[model samples]
Target chain A: MTVEKLYDAAGFKTISKGDGKKEVKAIFCCDMLSIAMSKAPASGCWITVVSNMNTLAVATLTDVSCVVIAGGVAVGEDMKAKAETEGIALFTCEEPAFETALIVHDLMNA
Target chain B: MSEVKLSYTISGDDFTRAGEASGDVKSKLKVLGVAPDIVRKVSIALYEGEINMVIHAHGGTIDVTISEKEITMVLADHGPGIENVELAMQAGYSTASENVRALGFGAGMGLPNMKKYSDDMNIETRIGEGTTVTMKVFLQ
Candidate 1:
């Protein structure tokens, strides 16, 4: 599915509309950057509670289609700017990472 | 015989810029027509090394050379050297502080992941002196 479609279906708040047309093929949930770095699939939607600059870096490195910041984590202004500059689709939601993953999973499978 | 060489100075004080070097290398490799998997592996390995330099060492320098046959990365740091290379190589081993963990790193997977991605990995360290890591990813 496309990032825009996921945003609409999941009802998550958008932070950066980077490559809204980008296709997402998988769902990965992880907060540990190292694991996420080595394991996150290309073009996957990442669900994580960690909101930091490093998150964007990892997203870029892993080539994730989008990053869904869950658990009500507060994203830094610098991170938001970096996400925009790097063309990384970013979304934020009050739901915990697991709940967000569930929603993404259902949408992806449906 | 033709190759592209890149170097960067990693700053220990800036947690936000840890991956800049790896990201640059990733882009360069992509432009160079390297395979997707090889590019990812090289980026991941170099990124882990960059993070380690920021967290463990005060800072360091990374030199990358991309050639037709392989990509070589040499990371050197002047911070307090690793106490035990063997233990550090174990998965789930990390000496990073709690502050570093809050940033979503310090899980002790940096070195191991570096090794996992590179075709050949070597570490040379001295107590109270520094450490140097050399890694290569072959292009096929």
Candidate 2:
């Protein structure tokens, strides 16, 4: 699915519309930057509560298609700006990570 | 022989900028048309090393050399050296404080992941001096 489609379907608040047409091949849920750095799939959607600069760095390194910030974590302005500059789609939802993953999983499989 | 050499000075005080160097290297590797899996491997290993430098070593320097056969990264830091290399290599062993864990790091997977991703890994350290990590990922 495309990032735009997931954003609309998941009801996530869009912070940055980076490459809305980018394809999302899978969904990964993890908060540990170390684990995500090595395990996150390329062109996949990353579901995490990590809303920091390093989160974007790992996302970029893993080539994740988009980052869905779960648990309504506050994202810093600098991080948002970096996401836009890096062309990484950023989204947020009040739901916790598992719930967020369920939403993404349903949409992705449906 | 054409080879690309890159070096960066990592600042220990800045946790937010920890992965900048690794991200830049990942981009460069991609631009060079390196395979995606290979790029990811190199990026992950280097990024783990970068984070370690920030969290434990009070920052450090990373030198990377990209050649046709392999990509080599050497990370050297002046902070307190690891007391036990064998234990540090074990997953789930960490000296990072609670604050570091709150940042979603300090899970003790840093060194293991670096070794897992790199084809060859080596660590050298002194009790009161410093530590240096050298890793290589072969381009097949």
Candidate 3:
């Protein structure tokens, strides 16, 4: 499914404009930047509560479909700016990280 | 002979700046039309190395050299060296602090991941002096 479709179904708030049509290959849930960078699929969506600038960096480096910050984590202004500059889609939701991953997984499987 | 040599210092004090050098190198390689797979390999290896420098060592320097045949990276740090390189090489071993783990790192996969992504990797260290990791990814 496209990122936009997932966003709509998952009820996530978009923080940056990206190609919503980008394919979603999988869902990788991890707060560890190194692990995500190493294991995240090319078109995966990373689910995490660790809302730091490095989150965007890892997402960009791995070429993930988008990043979903869970449980309404406070994203820094610098991180938002960097996400826009890097062209990586970012979103946030009130759900916890695990719940968010499950939602994305169900969406993908649907 | 092919070209491009770049070097950057990683500040141990700033966790946020850890991956900047690897990201820069990845962009440069992409601009040079390096193959996507090679770029990914180089990026992952260098990024893992960069994170290790910040989380373990106080900081370090990463030097990258790209030639027609391969891309090579050398990361050297003067922080507390690894007490046991073999144990550290084991997949799940880690000496990172709780604070580092809370940041979503310290899974003990950094070096192993680097080795997995690069075609070749080597390490040299002295317990008090520091550690230097050398890795190379072939263009072919």
Q: Give the best candidate by lDDT.
A: 1
Global lDDT of each candidate: 0.92, 0.91, 0.88
Show the lowest summed lDDT stretch of 10 residues, model 2 chain A.
A4-13
Cα lDDT tens digits for candidate 2, B66-104: 999999999999989999999999998999899888889
Residue pairs clashing in model 2 are: none
Candidate 3 wrongly placed segments (more than 4 Å): A6-10, A105-110
Tens digit per residue, CA lDDT, model 2, A1-110: 78888667655888888998888899999999999988899999999998898899999999899999999898889998999998989999889999998998888787
Q: TM-scores, in order shown?
A: 0.97, 0.97, 0.92
What is the DockQ of the complex in model 2? 0.85
The TM-score obtained by chain A of candidate 2 when compared with the true chain A: 0.94
| Model 1: per-residue Cα lDDT over B1-140, one tens digit each | 48999999999968989899999999999988899999999999999999999998988999999888999999999989999999999999999899999999988899999999999999999988899999999986
> What DockQ does every candidate get?
0.92, 0.85, 0.71
Clash total of candidate 2: 0
Candidate 3: residue pairs that collide: A31-B104, A32-B104
| lDDT of each residue in A1-110, candidate 1, tens digit only | 88987667555888988998999999999999999999999999999999999999999999999999998887888888999999999999788988989888887777
Quick one: best TM-score, which candidate?
1
Give the worst 10-residue stretch by lDDT in candidate 1 chain B.
B12-21
Q: What is the interface RMSD of each candidate, in Å?
A: 0.5, 0.7, 1.1
